[model samples]
Target chain A: MRIVASALVLSIPILTAAEAARGETLTVTLSHHQVRITSTYTGAELAVFGVIGRDGATAPRSGDYDLVVTARGPRANTVLREKRPFGPVWLNDAQVKFYDLPVTMAVLSSRPLDEIADVDLRRRYAVGLDTTRASNIAPPGAAVREEEFREALIRLKTQSNLYVQDERGVSFIAENVFRATVPLPATAPPGAYEVEAALFRGGVRLAVTQTSFEVTKTGLEQFLAREARERGLLYGAAASALALVFGWLATVVFRRD
Target chain B: MEFYLPIAEMPVHVGLVLAMSAAVGFISGMFGIGGGFLMTPLLIFIGIPPAVAVASVAPQIAAASTTGVLAHWRRRALDLRLGLVLLAGGVVGTLLGVLFFNAMRRVGRLEPIITLSYAALLGTIGGFMLVESVRAVLRARNGAVVDPRRRPRPRWFGLPFRMRFPQSKVHMSVIPPLAVAAAVGFVGAVLGIGGGFLVVPALIYLFRIPTAVVVGTSLFQILFTAIAATLFHAATNHSVDLILAMLLMFGGVFGAQFGAQAGKSLKGDSFRLLLALILLATAARFVLDMVVEPREPFSIMLSEVLP
Candidate 1:
């Protein structure tokens, strides 16, 4: 009761002054305990980092701050609020910092690897008409580039919701490397969705950020299907048969013996 | 590799290793072969390094073999005097084998050697033992039995170190048995097998030890060979990985015990023939691999599977 009374008396004088506030710096990171990769090193990931602290000029540790961080978009919003329960992360005596982390806050997809290219069909679909002029401007074999936007057209055709990074009190290390990905499941909603980055400290909301990306899923399946027409169905059947035999033998000897 | 884990990993479960050891124990006991013959390869196929698998198998081999020997001893099947002679040779041979193993590692060719050895050795031995046992089985079916009441042969009367073996009922020199023991030890060293297979053959064909005692006596010597191998690997090369090895051994011991019990009901020659056939088949596969140029040399061929 005495400690509460003293804090109340101290805050009363400060509350009346109503001074403007600033920002606070807190370091954030993640620590992964163990990681394993498949025999085929196709999948990889980026680590996410989150830091949380308060501005001494205005809001203290217990005070709320109207933090705004320019991130990809809002889906990162969910990750931004409240410190979670005990995880792989380690905390010091102060409980205000995170250390030597593992995965960063981004995941980049890998491409379809091919050992042999019998026919050059990696390029199949062209978005938009190239406005017709660019196709004429190029050499006979080359398809000219179109400066006109194709995303708006895609948006009308499919419900496109691109994820953008925007949040309060979250700074993201932007990964600008564009990736060529083939969708695995067609059920995946093709639209623009917000990619949010969040920060939580000591079980409290501290910061967040968001980003946006357009979902492009067309002609992806054709890449796998292209040149098989020349090989015919017999080879595919034989290959599938061999694969089944191999898989069976592998399971026989290799299953948790 | 620097050995890892026992008390290190979280949620420490020695129970898993212990249970596995028991299984390995059972199988090895039943088969009358140090399951290490199978353990190392099986572990590696599952991604455990060969060194760790071998190291772990040693301890479990000792444990399970002890149990097997105890049971056999109770049945008066084991010959302690024979085991002692074999141990002396085995300890020496194990040291040499560990040395060679290290040297092979330095050359980066242990895989080929190991692969070739397992495929060739087991397949050949299994095949030969199977054929021989089949013949004996056929003869027994025909009711052609050797007279058991005949006086003991004194063929080794002229040989040195002549001594009486009341169980064997022979007044013969100890030199042949010692030589056989030493030769088996040498092979066991190079192959990383417990030498039980070789010992059984020696007892049957050369030393004329009774077929009934072959399993028990070979197992007796195997315990010693395993101990020596474990110590040698531990002391000299530090090749024995206690953690991984123990994990494999744990499973192996239990498997061996159950195998031993199962083996108990089988006829002598039939059991021998089956064991030999397994050896031959596995060995033949190894040899075939060496001779048959696989379509893809770089294929992901698993040597063992995960437990």
Candidate 2:
């Protein structure tokens, strides 16, 4: 009886040890301004068996798992807090080499998704958020800009590594990498704003992320108008007068012929 | 100074708008026709709201149309009786057309209707012109007068209000001209055009009006229709884009003059063929738009904000 009891006691530790060795592990650190993760427990992994899936499937291959990730909220001790799973990837096995691993934890930034661009057709085509403005946004008595926004977008596209388009001047923006800082104008309408965010990995979509910001009318609209009017009113008026004079001159000059 | 369009974060430059305005102006100049056909489509393509495009084209059309009328007058092309008859019908048509336009808005079907109509109109005009031109060229090659002059039956002679056209040497019912003018006016209201294209062709083909008389009467009716359109857009939609219109008009008047001069050099067949090509191209673009699914989630639904 004593022998059997001792055997049972011995079996307890061995069975318990096997069950406890589930390989749930997470490690994080930084190298060369990039975060590196070493992991065994892949409960947070983005893919499985070369297919887009959850980490619950199987442990990822031991390598540098380059993934599309973002961090928002706050900073952590030498790392970002709330390190959650993020991906629809930018780099994969092809680009990011396995830096040395049995490691699986992906090191990522706390930097939130940043909008690279926004465009306005000027206030001429819009009224305080009217729906018809959805199709055409021309405000009353506003100087119609002939092709100004398109030209500006074309130029901006050339200068910055960005793509530009508009949904009837409702929204104009470019989609880029995860960690980025977008340029905003001084006259930006202020409100709790949501930006459309999409993530691409190796030219394929990985995930779409959204970020919010407080966009407020920074009083720049009024200032811009004052300036635009001061600049344009005179110029338009002058050009018109000149056209009449030129028309008269052309008539007179061609009279002899 | 900076300008902000609603969806964009940054303000746009006035200079850029001017460049676009110039492009519209160049088109107006290239074609003696009001560039409204180009303007409205181009505006929508570039992302101006539909209402805005319709509203803004008004002032610009007004200015450009005036210049055209003046130029045609100088050429001694104005036909008083024909122009007056067409104008009478055009005014009534424009008023009625506005009601239809509003009703379409109430039903939220304006854009689709307009786009489809535009494409259809342009496609028919272009196709007709191409066939007619080819036939004319073939007849010339065969050394034959293409149309054997069998006296066309006097379809309009017996109708009420027969009117004399000194220039055309025909006396026809005013009914046909009036009906044509009214229909064109309706198109103008819906499409934000002066309806000169619609008017000119019908006068030639349906009524057997001379090309010169057609041109004169078309312009005369266009003037009144454009004036009505301007007032309607302003009072109802309040969509008049004054600055934008002014900027575009600045280039439009001069461009129209140049286009008129250029049109002068082309033979009748050549002019018709070119017009046909333009119309066909415009029609194809609209067809493509309708057939191809939009990338965005929402399709526009139109409704009248005013009765």
Off by over 4 Å in 2: A1-110, A113-182, A185-257, B1-32, B107-118, B141-154, B297-307
Best candidate per DockQ, number?
2
Instruction: Give the alpha carbon lDDT tens digit for every residue of A129-183 in model 2.
Output: 1101112233332225313322332233223322222222211111111122222
Model 1, stretches more than 4 Å misplaced? A1-28, A31-47, A50-257, B1-24, B95-125, B146-158, B236-253, B288-307
For candidate 1, lDDT tens digit of each residue in B1-307? 1222321111113465555555555656766667666556655554444554665466567656665676566667677776676676666666676677777768763555566665666566666777778887888799975422233654654489776765554556777776667666666666666767566666665566665466667777777666655555555434344344445444554555456566778776776677676577556655664565443222111112111
Distance from true location, Cα of B80 in model 2, Å: 3.1
| lDDT on C-alpha atoms for all candidate structures | 0.44, 0.45
